[model samples]
Target: MSIEFYEEYIESNKAIIYKICRAYTHSKLEFDDYFQEVCLQLWKSKEAYNHQSKLSTWVYRVTLNTCLSIIKSEKREVDTVEINESFDHHSDLEDTEAQERLNTLYMGIRQLKKADRAIIVLYLEDKSYQEIAEIIGISMSNVGVKINRIKQQLKDSIVWKSLI
Candidate 1:
């Protein structure tokens, strides 16, 4: 693909890309790094997309796979880089209860297994089970079962957080 086309694609999918980065990265610097890498990988793998699914689904697959690969690599860093900018950009900051739930939910998600995290991210994005299965390369029935388990695990984690 041409540079202009790739740039346009990234611009159009910025929100989705950023959301994946935020979910998988622990720090702003890491998020930025992941975002750059995903964009590069997306462009590199553009030809592999055979139109078997929606373009967004292909993007999600690439993004998630890139993240998982980064996390699994031996050269991955353990120490997080601190960012100068605060990441408290919640849109509905005035709603305290909702904010707390959102925070707790993110905390719970961070503790999940990598594959489970991918599944839940898609679930939260309101992707259909079949779409998620396609992105994650799982069967639809397995996606349903895993989602149920992951949801229960998230609830347990959130409840535990409330106690503390």
Candidate 2:
């Protein structure tokens, strides 16, 4: 890679890789291993990185694949943090609420099948349905249909659990 391109990747992708690592592992050791694995995967896929998809989309795809390939993750410790362009810290109370929501979100995501989780993560991160469909190799209408079905399934499962 050119110096400029390498620097660009460093500037934009460092934190993304870290977040993916934390999302996929619970311990510092596992985080280090997975972080390296993700970086290696990203490096290997550099030639295949098409500009047609957003950079973050590509990163998420690689990260998910790496996580799925890992054999020993029984517990996941990551939160669904929303990144805003304005960089608002929000209040500590809001952070607590966000963390709670994130826990719920992760639990809900864990309830999904591999395919469903991909769509949900992308949707939660505010990707356009068209972009998400393209990234996941599905049709646009299928994306909406899958999301609706997953939402219903989640609702039903939650309601059923309360009865127990």
Candidate 3:
């Protein structure tokens, strides 16, 4: 792909990349690094995209693979970081509550195994089972099974946290 096409592709999929990076990284610095690395990897592998799957699918696969590899190389356990440490004091109560819920969910997600984390993130992003299977290289039925199990785990985690 030409530079122009690649730039357009990145623009279109930037949110997906950002969400994946945030799901994998603990700090803004790590998120920035992973985002850059994912973009670079996409550019380097541009020619290898054989049009066999949707561009979004390819992007998800690449971003997830890149993040997983980075975590593996670092050999450090993934830890949860407060997504936005400086809360906006002027925000509405409802908005603050929503943000807190999201942060709690993300913290739970971060504690999951790398593969489960990827699956749940994709599911949350509204990717269909087929799309998730394509990105994750799992059978569609397996996607359903994993998602159900992951949901239960997250639910259990949240419930356990509430009891503490």
Q: Which candidate has the highest lDDT of all? A: 3
Please estimate how well model 2 matches the true structure, expressed as its whole-model Cα lDDT: 0.63
Each candidate: what lDDT? 0.77, 0.63, 0.81
Per-prediction TM-score? 0.81, 0.64, 0.85
Question: How should the candidates be ordered by lDDT, best one leading?
Answer: 3, 1, 2
Clash tally, candidates in order: 0, 0, 0
Off by over 4 Å in 2: 1-7, 10-32, 71-94, 157-164
Worst 10 residues of 2 by lDDT: 82-91
Q: Which of the numbered candidates is closest to the native, going by highest TM-score? A: 3
lDDT of 2 by residue, 9-98 (tens): 534766555544444444467667877787777777887987886787788778768877763354432333222111111113357667
Model 1 Cα lDDT, one tens digit per residue, 1-164: 57676766677767667767666776677778888899889888888989877888878888888988888784654332322233433234777777766656766776787788889989998999988898888999999999999999989877876797
Point out where model 3 deviates above 4 Å: 1-3, 79-94
Candidate 1: what lDDT?
0.77
